[model samples]
Target: MTIQVLPEQLINQIAAGEVVERPATVVKELVENSLDAGACAIEVELEAGGLNLIRVRDDGGGIARDQLALALTRHATSKISLLDDLERVASFGFRGEALPSILSVSRLALTSRREIDQHGWKVAGSGLLDDGSPQPAAHPPGTTIEVRDLFFNTPARRKFMKAEGTEFRHVDQALRRLALTRFDLRLRLSHNGRRSFELAQAEGDTARAARIAAVCGDEFLANAVTIDEQRLGLRLWGWVALPSFGRAQADLQFLYVNGRNVRDKLLAHALRRAYHDVMHSQRHPAFVLFLELDPARVDVNVHPQKTEVRFRDASVVHDFLFGAVHQLLRRIRPEPGQHHRVEFEAPAFSTPDPVQSSVPLSYGRNVSTPSWPVREASGASGSAWPLYRAGFAEPEMPAALNATEDAPLGRAIAQIRGVFVLAENRHGLVLVDAHAAHERVLYERLKLQLAADGIASQRLLLPEVIRVGGAEADQLEAQFESLRRFGLILDRAGPESITVRAVPALLIKADLAALLRTLCGGADDAESAEHFNEALDAQHRILADIACRAAIKANRRLTVPEMDALLRDMEQTPNAGQCNHGRPTWVQIDADALDRLFLRGR
Candidate 1:
């Protein structure tokens, strides 16, 4: 058979397959066009989950009466014209296929009237190349695209559509995704007859949070932290929920490039890596992040739907996003007055390790660690409170000096249940998980020791041999040098076995076989360099195990002075808000919360 050009209608329908999948895609494309047209307000009405009807009305720059026919023509886009324009296209809908492609499959009616026109014009069609001309219609200084009986002409495509309720949910999600990107635009949606949502134009952070709560939920808003970081020609600003508030699935995660909503893998990987240390393996971090950069730096024409993009320097963007989010989660310490709120700083590209860099976690008068008055104790466990080992505990305090200011986390008053430490701060009552806090403190110290002179390698009495898969042995062979940095030396004894010659001096007491299994847990899959760096810099799960064992055990008796000393150590530790497993080490319950608990005011 000889190749031949397909019919114009068929060609449009085929192109539509790439962008228009179901009612959701149709809603998304129409709304994207409205946004590019500079619409300040958009109202979308759906019938039968947008299969029977999808009407989108936008108060934007309406098309000219003469160009009404051209609007139904393929490749006629007002967003871009030249190669240069295509390279750095800023608008959402640039390919101009959304209108004609939808027209070929559905009964489409376009109505518009510019500000200068006396009345609006309407053109109706159910085909790509409609010969009908625009007719005089009622007045309106905006544009409206009414798509009726979507896929009515294409029965085969319509057959693949999901159930009515499922399709409507998808359409609702599409509208909300767009609404999140543009807070200035008042986007409203209606299903069947009743209103689904009418999002007002939000201005301030409070309004933004309200809108987010409306779209996501109130639970997300309560635990969300607003972030705004600008660095090296890129700015990322939005809300990221705490790790504790993370979800089982990534449904609530919304990301936007510039102003257009997108789902890029590079962006996803960067954000996931940022949450690697804090969140569990099965949990997904919930975030609404927007990354902004020069238009020339990103290409939005990677697909007809414009949902994925190609960055000029993907590594740079990845590092910027990862560093910003990673560092912010670490600095989530309590601030004066605002107890749970997090303050954002322009994150530097290089996220420095607090122990190695200039975080100043010294045991001297450099910044003066708080000195708590010690009460005399006579128990045998008194000596056990301060663990003595390699890379543990500095010299005892240089006498007690009164703190000049009331610390964010005030002095510890008592220890209860042998598991929690109760402290009295200016911000009411503060409860801390004693074991979790101590684990974090020891973890940071371990990292500091590893970074300084390298953890001393402890040789086993008889080199313990552990079995493994052939692939695991191959990877172990390649990563020997990196593993040695953490004082781990391995040898491939056979095709499916590995011999461990030495272990980290700090982890000598840990079960060596279990530690080896945990380190090589997911080493089979091919990972990116960033992921490799994460694994190499800190294979934290193993370190966390060591820290857990070395931490102040629960049910261990402690005097007031021993507890107070632990509290001071927590204040100086980085990422001290959470333990290595991402569970929060401490929580704040202010006076108001306490009052409400007892119904005092009521």
Candidate 2:
């Protein structure tokens, strides 16, 4: 091959290949152009899933007559002129290659009538980069671009296109993404002359929520949390679905930087970490978030498809995103009458109120009487169940909240099946997994203690010995300090043996010997020390195990006060909605729903 610069037509075709991967890509590029043209109302028409024809008509600022031909030329753009403009370009089609690229591989005709013009001008062409002199044509004030025979010049590219239905689905999905990101714009799509969907412009919180329901699905909105936070010139606003309303894949996760939808890994990683503890394993959280920041702080020209962006200080952005979402999610200690869509429809329990009354919760007796924490086995030494199990016997807790409205979990009414706690709140019925709730409470306490003065360690009556591989023993030594912080005191006896001198009080009953072996067995020495101490799932598993074992056992009887105390603790706990294992801690059945079930209204 001779060393030669590629011809303009071939170059444009290559660029088209980069952005236009399939019918969906064509829709994306064309619609992006329409958006950049300041289109408020845009209609996307497709035939044969956009393979045979794609027509995007928009009511916006249209190209002028003299510029009609220039619009078909590569690199000719009205979005940015100065080099600085490229750095802070706000428009979606600043590159200006989308038009010429699509024109190179397909038959393209652009017709537009500027606001000042009485008649429209049309420039029609296929490949050859020919501007083709504009001809006068009557058109409404706006722009209409007709693209036909996509990839006609390259049969191989057309062959890669999927079946009609599959392709249309892709196009539909793409349009939906755009609609969600640009809620202020009206977008409509039609396939084979049949209207697929038509979204009207959405304004205000209620209207935006309606748009979200229409585009992302009503189920998602029903189960999502609305977040609007602004700090240091960064604003993150949108809906994040509850952990229970997850997806099998990340298809429903839509993240837009400024106003452009992108797939930045930093943002994705932060979201993952935010939902890490609450989400079920292998499930992806669904969200439609828009992050707005100083345009100069983010570079949008990082990827060819413009689906990724680079932040000037990526770590700052990541932390801000993570903190905002993480804090909001933690603060979401369910409002009354509203449980996540995973189960029961109604308001759910929330945090505790400071107003307390000395009167005992009424489950047929005075909660003021200390009747529940009758220590059976061990006494003070057992912090696991050490000083009285969650009960009415609490001399430490001041008093239980009197009003049902104040007590979000409501006054505990009774215990059921030794596993669940049945309660009545202002909203309606609230059923709680006693074990799960206690487990979460204990887990949170343990973590807080771990963060504060380090978990209180209790010396074992007798040291437990464990045997492991030589490499495992080495790991045990390396992570000794890190383990010590979690209240694990270890000593390496030999190349394959170690002794556990003391354990966290909560884990006193756990099989320390076996658990130690598991923790040390698969230890990744290659991992960073910070990550090893903080992000290790194995470390969390150990704590979770301790909480699980220490939690109120199934089938145990409890007094109203004991149950009330547990509910109070749950109200104060973060992520109290779910247990350590991702199972919901409580479910709410609305009083209205209960009435409807019995036909009370009828």
Q: By TM-score, who's the top model here?
A: 2
| Model 1, TM vs. native | 0.83
Model 2, position 582: C-alpha lDDT score: 70
- State the C-alpha lDDT per candidate: 0.76, 0.78
Off by over 4 Å in 1: 335-405, 457-484, 488-508, 520-538
List model 1 lDDT by residue over 4-98, tens digit each: 99999999989888878999999999898888888999999999999999999999989898999898889998878899998888888888888
Q: Which ten residues in a row have the lowest lDDT in candidate 2?
A: 365-374
In the range 485-574, model 2's lDDT, one tens digit per residue, is: 778899998989888899887677777766765565454545423333566455566577668777888877876667877877777677
